[model samples]
Target chain A: MREDHHDQPHAPDHPMTEFEWRVDAVQALLIEKGVITADEVRRAVEEMDARTPAQGARVVARAWVDPAFKARLLADAKATIAEIGITVGFDATIVAVENTEKVHHAVVCTLCSCYPRGLLGYPPDWYKSLNYRSRAVVEPRSVLSEFGLELRSDVEVRVLDSTADMRYLVIPVRPAGTEGMSEEELADLVTRDSMIGVAQARTPALR
Target chain B: MTRVHDRGGWPGSGPIDKSEHDLSWWEKRTDAIASLLMSPEKRVMRVDELRRAIEDMEPARYEQSRYYAKWLHAIETIMAEKGVLTREEIDRKVRELSARR
Candidate 1:
């Protein structure tokens, strides 16, 4: 009987919880009813798995190297990102906020985990945590500091709340040095935290 | 009126948990299920509808469930509401799977 469980898809070492079992049951029934095919589920999982911070890094690196593209990304993020071959299936508008010496920007979806999943994969656990969702809007400096990003007094901190219809991706300023580095190399320096605006892009020395 | 799901600026929510774990197999499948159901080709439900379901959860239950678990709750709620699947059918399926184990 236990072996039968192993034969099942996504069987865990321990017994599945009620919620976990419900997830399986939902999928099974949905497939049975022809609402969604197993193949479609597999394809969706693969598509989501394929998306990662790397894609967002590629976009940011391009913006760092190309002034024209940066302007376009800020002007129209949804279409500009699509031009780079990243498919955004949803209709939510993505806004690219630039982090400069005078201003810093961080993103939080206070209502729910409304991230730009099409570009940066799923939101991190902390991004969806109540602490972040509650404090990011009111006390962004403290939140950024916990992420090891200490901004100077002169820099204005802006916390962008991601709504159901709007998502924000922060473009951290390029680190000092590495003047002649290639776009690929620059992409390597763009960490996920940096793009979320909790931290800045990695300096060349750190990379 | 602020709902339980609307937690912006609620104060003293504590520090952000930086730890991250790889999604469990069921969690991944739940996400995939949601994406496919809400995909343009299927249009069985919209993201907004799913979100509304989540927001409609009781405050205590909403806070207790894990992230993907909340999504599952939402999916089940929407499915039942849309007449795609009933709670009774899902309950029976769960029992069937449990009996096999």
Candidate 2:
């Protein structure tokens, strides 16, 4: 939901809506009832703020170099991600799907804004969009092309639709010509878009 | 069964907005509330209940609002259902806050 909802009016464009007031109203109610402390709410915001795509980049870079780790990540994504210190929210499971030369994997939460928040941080604005939710499922190739990512025709495009309980992380193929790069350096080539399978990993020149 | 929240692959949907935006102050609070409510240890509200609450809104409202607005609305609805707070209290709080501004 973080993206600019172009179809919707902005709060700045007008006064706060009824629901906007409700957000503040509800928080005040919770604080007064002792259901949740103000500190906890502050910390929750801090927790999300602390996460970044860098965490996901680190995971992707490690997967690129460590065949063993990639195997584990593919087998049991949540656990393997935890081994590298990525912890998803309790209500969800993170699934890692790899893209190879023969098949490309793209992710979409057709239902809602489900995402691998533990790794890539908050879902990007576009990911929560109604346009993306609908388009990515049936027209992934076209959608990817919109992002300027044109896949080879030979590669089969697979769209992984995320659910509330199970989210997906697309492990894009490492770009060629970076044979000796360290994991840290390799991390630099991974972008948030690439991890979501909207774009390819950065080539050496891009890094 | 196809609610407005079930938005996958709907033809003639608006164009996707790829631009990212900063979390506004209230948006941050909404996110925090959602996370806090979903925590198992807290047991304040369940995601299923929240989703249902969101879907229960009129289609026009659903179409007009953004994502976090849905969460905030759902949380307000579900929390009231669970006896955590009443709608009256929320409205009074809103009025009180507005008067100060």
Alpha-carbon interface RMSD for all candidates, in angstroms: 1.3, 3.2
Predictions' DockQ, in order? 0.78, 0.60
lDDT by residue for model 2 (A1-207), tens: 212212235465567767677787787778778888777888888888777888888888999999999999889888887897777657677788898999898888887777878667778889888899999987888899989899989999998887657778888899899899999999999898988899988999965
Per-model TM-score on C-alpha atoms: 0.95, 0.91
Which lDDT value does model 2 have at A21? 71
TM match of model 2 to true structure = 0.91
Output the number of the TM-score-best candidate: 1
Off by over 4 Å in 1: A1-12
Docking class of 2: medium
Give the CA lDDT, 0 to 100, for residue A181 in model 2.
93
lDDT of 2 at A138: 79
